[model samples]
Target: MGRKQSFTATELLDTTKRLVLEHGYDGFHLKLLSEHLPGARSTIYQYYSNKEEIVAACMKHVIVTVLEQASAVDETDAMSALQQLLLIYVGESQLHQLLGDAYKINTANSPAAANDLEFVEQAHLTLKSQLTRLFERAQQDKKLRNDIPLPVLVGVFFNLINTPNMLNIPTPQWSELLFQMWIGGARS
Candidate 1:
């Protein structure tokens, strides 16, 4: 076989993620990917039509995992809890990068993402629900001013946290940078 998938889809994603981390997205191309995994181009295509879909799958997998981890953080100080959540999404230990680049790519090109968009939107709604709860708690506890609505906070918070690469900041700076703005909503 010219293409060898020594790894399963999970393994292929892990390898793809590692390759992306090591070489960036441009370095991970369809030809190169199929070459690394043996069988045929069609085999890899069976799992993902393009390299973009593979990247999207890897990201969606991580995001779903992160939300699950944060599910147990039911505290009045949800923003404080977010500091910890931020670690999973943005910290050095982060698996696929803060918000998953391939997911963003698919979303930005939503017509192509139609297959997974419903599931993705549902997942986002769930995360937003969690954030909404946190904001509600914050307002009740008076840690966050009550003027801002939960839906708005959810939108703004997600947009800020989901800014992909911050472009120039050092790796250590991401969580603090994100939280500073996250905590900004609480200002009276």
Candidate 2:
């Protein structure tokens, strides 16, 4: 039988995600990725043809995870669901920054990369729809203030993902604190 692979796809993708977030799409390169991985540089090629493919695959992997977790959230209590969803989004906050560089990826030569980007786009729409649904439900249930426009509230909620965790608190508590601040305001 052929020799076993030194690293799994998840490991490679996870490393790719970290590097991309650290270096950005413009700074990220296959050479840098190989430096952090366990196997030889050629091994990366075996998994992905080029940087575009790898980065696109990494983006797709992240959004897919967020999509899964967001979908699993129960909507019976819209406000509760929004809190949980915020936690999920905060956990993968890097995804928002990563997706911002998606347009820089040239998919002309790589169908796999193109397909992965397409999935990312579709998954983004799905997540947006879910968030909108929850917000509307919450507003209808009178859980949220009716004065502010839904889009404004939704925009602010989404912006919370970018809030700096200056204290480096754990994700669970950080998310909870944010949700509370969003609902209860900063005033004592």
Best by lDDT: 2
Tell me how many clashing residue pairs each candidate has.
6, 0
lDDT of each: 0.64, 0.93
lDDT (10s digit) by residue, model 1, range 29-58: 777766666566677766777766776676
TM-score of candidate 2 versus the correct structure, residues matched by position:
0.95
- How far is 102's C-alpha from truth in model 2 (Å)? 0.5
Each model's TM-score?
0.57, 0.95
Runs of candidate 2 with Cα error greater than 4 angstroms are: 1-5
Instruction: Give the clashing residue pairs of candidate 1, or none.
Output: 3-37, 3-38, 3-39, 4-37, 4-38, 5-38
Candidate 1: where are CA atoms >4 Å away?
A: 1-5, 15-29, 35-56, 92-115, 147-188
lDDT of 2 by residue, 1-188 (tens): 66644788899999999999999999999999989987679999888999999999999999999999999999899999999999999999988889999999999999999999999999999999998999999889899998999999998898888899988999999999899999988999
